[model samples]
Target: MENNTIIKTSLDPRSTFDKYEKRPLINAVTTESYEPKPQAHNSKIIIESIIHGFDNFRKFSRFYAFMGLVAGSFFSSLLAVDNLSQLFPTFFNGYLQYIVPHFFMHLYIVGLNQLADLEIDKINKPYLPLAYGEFSFTNGVITVASFLFLSFGSAWMIGSKPSLWSLLVTFVLMTAYSINLPFLRWKKSTTLTVMAHAIGMTTSFNIAAFMHMKTFVLKKATTYPRSLFLATVVMAIFFAVVAMAKVFWFCVSLLEIAYGAAILIGASSPFLWSKLFTT
Candidate 1:
């Protein structure tokens, strides 16, 4: 419709045909020459890519969820306080060794899940790096692979049996939950999906982290103290909510309400008993 656009296109045969066909976009985008921006040095490109990779890793990994895992590990370790003096150096050193590899394992699992659910994520969680196209699929594969390598390699290097088992089982369950391969992709099955996450969270996060502190960090014999009930509470509170996020918002809300009510009831029970006994 603009005189400038029509006059410009009238000169070029290709543009003439486009006008003859009455293309809507003919006037929409001006025929501007496309030029590639000046190339950065190869080393610069590599550095930028590395920076993007780290940013993508941060985007993909849930820091709050990861911190919850860390908190679980921290408290579980406290459950195994055999000797106060051991807390000074031995416990701190051993906890770091367990945590470092676990962090890598956490990245691998979350990254792998995002990679596998790229298409679904565009619908469910478009803000995710992979879904948003900020992180390419090829780079996702590379990052996840690197995390997997670091997870197991560091665990083995430290010669920690608890960390080894922790990473191993978590890897297997996460693979089952996310990968699209045959007999995998447990997310397709309601039963398998819940089972995978329940076991993964309860066992890998709850038991493994607890065991790491009890055995490796504190050098204590494996014993389930009353304090270890904290792990069970964690499993009950967190496991289903995350795993069931796929299913129904109602269920997630229900679990939250139930947990909140339980906390209130637990807190009030002592006062209720005092009234009963006094009466």
Candidate 2:
């Protein structure tokens, strides 16, 4: 009877409740309030931001652009080949020399456009990295700058006059299109936008033509045929029309116009026809 009385006294309900209640407060004041050191925490944040930045960059569809560039390069090289014996060599060499550099060039242009359009994107594309606060503007700028550097640097290494000139011209035009500081944001006006796209597309096609011609020259063959020139012009016009159509149309209407344009261009260019048919 004495032991039972002692045990009941020690097991007081109020005391147990007090002890249990104090534990959470103690944890709140100590462990719950504790933070990891700033160095590791900040490093983690920086790494995550970089990862998100790249994820945002991939949203630009870089792989598709890269593959398109590669295809263009290969197709142009084939058209430039006057003889079957030189085909494989020209195709391989041009692909090796041109595709990587052009990919970076296109990437630079895309990054600049995104950086300049952050505010507009908030209303139009809130899910974008900058609009959603996933990528800081500073990091975005750094990324664009890095792409610009890689593009021009790779072109210089290639040491091709056409590649260098094309990169330079494209860079200047894209800067005018995206940068507002010098009052050259052509994206504001539909006319200017179409004009810019026209010129940009023309220049891009010319770069492929030039690359093709370079490959032929290296093999001591005649320059690219007049057919190649015609094909390039038709393709340029097709791209320009498609770009304008995108600004004006939506949904099925846009697809109809784009497909119609593609069909017309394809019909006009034996090179494009052959390539498409072969594929």
Candidate 3:
């Protein structure tokens, strides 16, 4: 009887409610999901910013590749200037001084475009930082302004007139291309947009690059080579076409790449024929 009474007492429901006897409540702590601050330039933000800023990193990569080839295919200038083993390093150093600053300028250019095209991008390219709401308008403004200041300031510091001019001209062009204010938004006008983009991307970039390397690196008088002129013409059309295709088609297909290749080859054929005849 005593044993049964003890068992009954231990089994009491009120006793089971003792806090001390309670096992740690499984998942007792309520978990709340956290959404990141929209404009925070934290790790995720920084990564997205970089991805956006440096998107199509090839935009400027060809500058180096083409210029490097122009300077020398094998440890010397096409004119056979020697001591290039040492001079090549010098060339790269100067190139970086000029190109690195322009990188920030490129960032500003692309960011400004995004700011103006947020709605279109949401439907077309939602992964963009601003389009997806990861970046706010204020954040976009601040970042774009900072990049602009950095690019302009650094170009001035480099003391290269060609470099500074390149940044200035490209900025003005891109600003005009993307800004929505009256008389400035070239994107609304197909002809104006194409003209501005082609000129800004091709003539400005190529001519400025040639001037920089020639005057700054080769230490020579500014002279435009035939090949350089040819390059600008071809690349200008290519860039314009690509821009249109990308904006309208939303992607650059392999067929477009093959088309570009054919264009390049066909465009060069005339020059090749003339050169062959002359040589």
RMSD of candidates 1 onward, in order: 12.6, 6.9, 8.9
- Candidate 3 colliding pairs: none
Q: Write one digit per residue (lDDT tens) for candidate 2, span 82-174.
A: 577765765566656766677788888877887898899889988766677777889888878888899889878777666677677778877
Best by lDDT: 1
Error of 1 at 60 (Å): 2.5
- Estimate the TM-score for candidate 3: 0.62
Model 3 misplacement above 4 A: 1-87, 246-279
- Which has the better TM-score: candidate 1, or candidate 3? 1
Per-residue CA lDDT of candidate 3, range 117-193, in tens?
88998999887778777678898889889889998999888888877887888888889999999899998887787
So what's the TM-score on candidate 1? 0.69
Which stretches of candidate 2 lie above 4 Å from their native place?
A: 1-54, 60-62, 206-209, 212-224, 246-279
- What lDDT tens digits, residue by residue, belong to model 1 across residues 170-260? 8998898899999999988877877787777666556776788788776678887544554565465567676677657766785876566
